[model samples]
Target: MFDAVRNNRKIVQIFLVLICLPFALWGVDSYVHGGGAGEDPASVGDTKITAQQFQQAWRQQQDRLRQALGANYKSEEANTPEARLAVLNSLIDQRLLALEANQARLGVSDEALRNFIARIPSLQENGAFSMARYEAALSAQGLSQPQFEAQLRQDLTLQQLVGAVGESSLVAKSSTDAIMRIEAEERQASEFRFPAAQYSAQASVDAAAVKKFYDENARLFQTPERARAEYVVLSQEALLAQVKVADEEVKAWYDGHKDRYQSAEERRASHILLLDKDKDPAKTKAAAEAILREVQAQPAKFAEIARSRSQDPGSANKGGDLGFFARGMMVKAFDDAAFKLKDGEVSGVVQSEFGYHIIKLTGIHPGKQRSLEEVRPEIVAELKRQASAKRFAEAAEAFSNMVYEQADSLKPAAERFGLKVETSGWLAKAPKPQDLPAYGVLGEPKLLKALFADDAVKNKRNTDAIEIAPNTLVAARVVEYQPAAARPLTEVSAQIESGLKLREAAAQAKKAGEAKLAELQKGGEDKLAWSATKTFSRLQPLPAPPAAARAVFQAPVGKLPAFVGVTLDNGDYALYRVAKVSQPEAIDEARRKAVEREYSTLLAQEDFAAYLAALRARTKVEINQKALEASDR
Candidate 1:
């Protein structure tokens, strides 16, 4: 039922990915920080990294991974010492950037901050910013608008500092051309195989060898424990469909929140901004007035003039179009000038905090009241969600108690909460995150651990209900269990013997291939039979085994018929004859441009890394081991 600002609102997303992938954090040297209110996981200079700070950052990273990977997210994997260290390091990097930015007196403007927040997809509704949705999102995250705005401002300031550092990075023309030449060179080659299978007859493993190898590698022959389980999930989504919202409630909500449903009067405007860089405001105003006269004489050419003359980086490229915005969204002078103009009318020269502006009003959307019928479905859904949340909270405790009190069956809790008890196929004791999707919600680590626990597996009991997600609780019972066991030596003897023989055969093949390669390099004639020739380069490569292809590409092309050999993991040895080398007739212009962009990006990444390392070297850091280890919560 809540809707506001019906306009095509676009934000200039001022994001610059100048650093390395994932993150590039500052290095730290440890010291001690005493007399703190509580334990700190880490500290940068005088600033302490609180447990709450570390955990929040960790949770945000985990949430991003979960959204990006969907069902493949592993909570346990992220809650590791390594991940915690990375998270703490990122926070330190951010702090360093903030410190540098503050000292540099860098700042983000009101318009930039509003537009940046507007660009957040979750805070938007129907392709526009919604005040109610923004409020709700902040509430859900336990953040106030001021708190969020402060963090956002700090982030934008960091962007400014880092973007400057990254954009300053330069790539040499010679470097780019050299890399292009190296990648463009192609070599024609044919393979000569020294097959390990040919040497298998001479390779042997006696009883003493097999017994010793088998004894040392006992775990290799053992099978991991597996289980099949039945589980039930209790979540707000499960309760939402069942919790009905009455027509009366929907109508009452719409009537009470009519003010929230009023679409705002938004104006679309384009402007040409002129900055007084040399502290000469009078000159800047005169220049803006001249542009204003030109714009007034020919309103149709306002965008064209703005594109060439406007100094605003945020909007000049788009012909100075700031999209549609409500009143008071801009600075006071700019706002008044923009809203006063009629569609297709150009405004007189206006002065604002940024600079002088010549404004042109392009479009207008008038304020309108939304009808009750139009917002009924939205009101119903909101009411349903509210009711579901309250009901879910009450049922969650009962669900947990029933699963533990009864301790034998999940049916009591399932039937009481109207949830279905789903069964899974064989589940591993410690399944890889990629394999967890097969088990559904039972893939949750805590539930899986409970399913295979001694009490549950030995005495057929239901697991204690665990909150797997925000509002999702799960309890599972082990239906079938398989304990970890090793295969008998008698059963594995043949397999062991074959493995030993194959390994020895591979060693022999490698030795022979390398000897031949050495001889060929010394100008000795090879009587070896070669296979059909095929061409390859760095860009276009061979299939199947990649190690052999890598060896070929990396081999020197100084002499004709140069030789290179590689031992295969599967017990085969290959020697390649580098017969010919040639370059393409013409290098594609588009591919050259792509490489230029990639090389520039690489330079930017390295520059940013060096900058961070410099900051870390000067800044003192202290890490509390006990607090860090206890932060698994």
Candidate 2:
């Protein structure tokens, strides 16, 4: 029903990467337990939706919203009952789909899964699948190969079920025709606007009116609660600068992993392909052999002959060049033949799935390993990175323990890690974008909750070390705190007066416009000037205001001319006179087909929604409200 279903293959590939891969990016804690140890958040039929799964889904959604909304995103908004229920419903839907898929015995084969992984552009190097890059990427996300592959296979299976439901939709021609008729119907209209600004000079406001407004809206004048803190950060980058690697360690690592630096052999080859589609196999092979002999006899004419004889459309115009390729990149038979030939040498006829090929080897690059001197800088950097990682792991535990054991001040932890205690500017519970660096761990939800705990703020104790991001620990102590308070009425009187005056002006304008409309309907004339007539339809928008356009289309068509009035967004009023209504001559074939496709997609979406509703009704869904609320905390 979504465009993702219509353009199924490409969209599914993108969805697989974005959805499945990010599960691994959630870190090692995500994989510790597949389900929570306590009560379930929800249950679908016989299966339970675990608390851990719901929590992970909530966090992933929060991260996605933060990225999309940027500075406008607030993490606390996700802690509400409605947001938690939405997440629970999504988990229930996924469980239902997975149950159906399992019952149907639908699956993805290993070969198909491998091919899909190979095609992912992120795992490739130089347009070819790189095993080293693939392993490194998975390791960086903290996922094993089997874990990623299993998730990918499950997603592909679910896509098969979704595609089956979406592709079966049908659209009737009569329905399409009826829709087009209404969409193509056009109206011509004239408008007269009553501007609110014209009445502003007549509006009067006194001190009593301003005082009443300010009293009723006192909440708008309150200042938010703020706090300032001193904190320290222990991150991997900070530790990396302190780590030092010796020359002997670098040499030892290089010697143990010498095979990692060896480059694979590559070959550059061109071929003349003879088609076996209509001709006999023997004849095709004989022709290929003849071309090979001619090429061997006259090497310069190989390109000329290939251009006329090759059957591959992609390479025929380019003299049948296949470019340079490493082993396992091409078919086994072709790779074997090409690698066996020396530079500037020709080979006999070779048979493949496509046709018979007369191969010519133009270049060869032998496999070689770099000397330690040539790669000394790279080895040293890798050794230092490895050493830094080990040190960070050891220091992270110490940092957490010290902060907890010595809860009064950050000075002990900072002295232990050699990190300076830094002071931050005023920070609110909901920090702005510019305050993120100063707030540090206070910007994170869990740490912010802890920092605002009754004891931490009142007693001036330090928070427990929190992992704000991967491998980054932070802890803070409150240095100053201020409670929320309301500002004095004198400071906000001017704003209140200005707001009340504008509202009074808009009300006066609306009253005058209504009186004028009534007089015009009773055959009286006014001095207001009307704009030129413009045509509009449901599909083709006019330059008039949206309220005016909507009124023009909704007015009765039987009456030759009709009048309608509406309030515009600028606090102005508009009266529209509908003059003429016209129907389209005919619907073009191309546009009709497009409309039919769109209509069918809408029908399919409704069908799918109904199907899901039916499935929900048939199953017994039990939700633990208390457990759901506890999980949010």
Candidate of highest lDDT: 1
Clash statistics: count for each candidate: 0, 0
Measured against the true structure, the TM-scores of the candidates, in listed sequence, are 0.68, 0.68
Question: Candidate 1, after superposition: displacement of residue 623 in Å?
Answer: 2.0
Model 2 regions more than 4 Å off: 1-168, 174-192, 204-215, 240-264, 270-321, 328-340, 344-360, 366-384, 402-422, 431-442, 531-563, 576-588, 619-633
Instruction: Give residue 245's lDDT in candidate 1 (0 to 100).
Output: 78
Candidate 1, residues 552-631, lDDT tens digits: the string is 87788887888899987788999998899988777677867666666666666667789889999998877787888888
Residue 334 local lDDT, model 1: 84
- Distance (Å) between predicted and true CA of 328, model 1? 10
Query: How many Å off is the CA of 542 in candidate 1?
Result: 3.3
Q: Candidate 1 — worst ten consecutive residues by lDDT sum?
A: 1-10
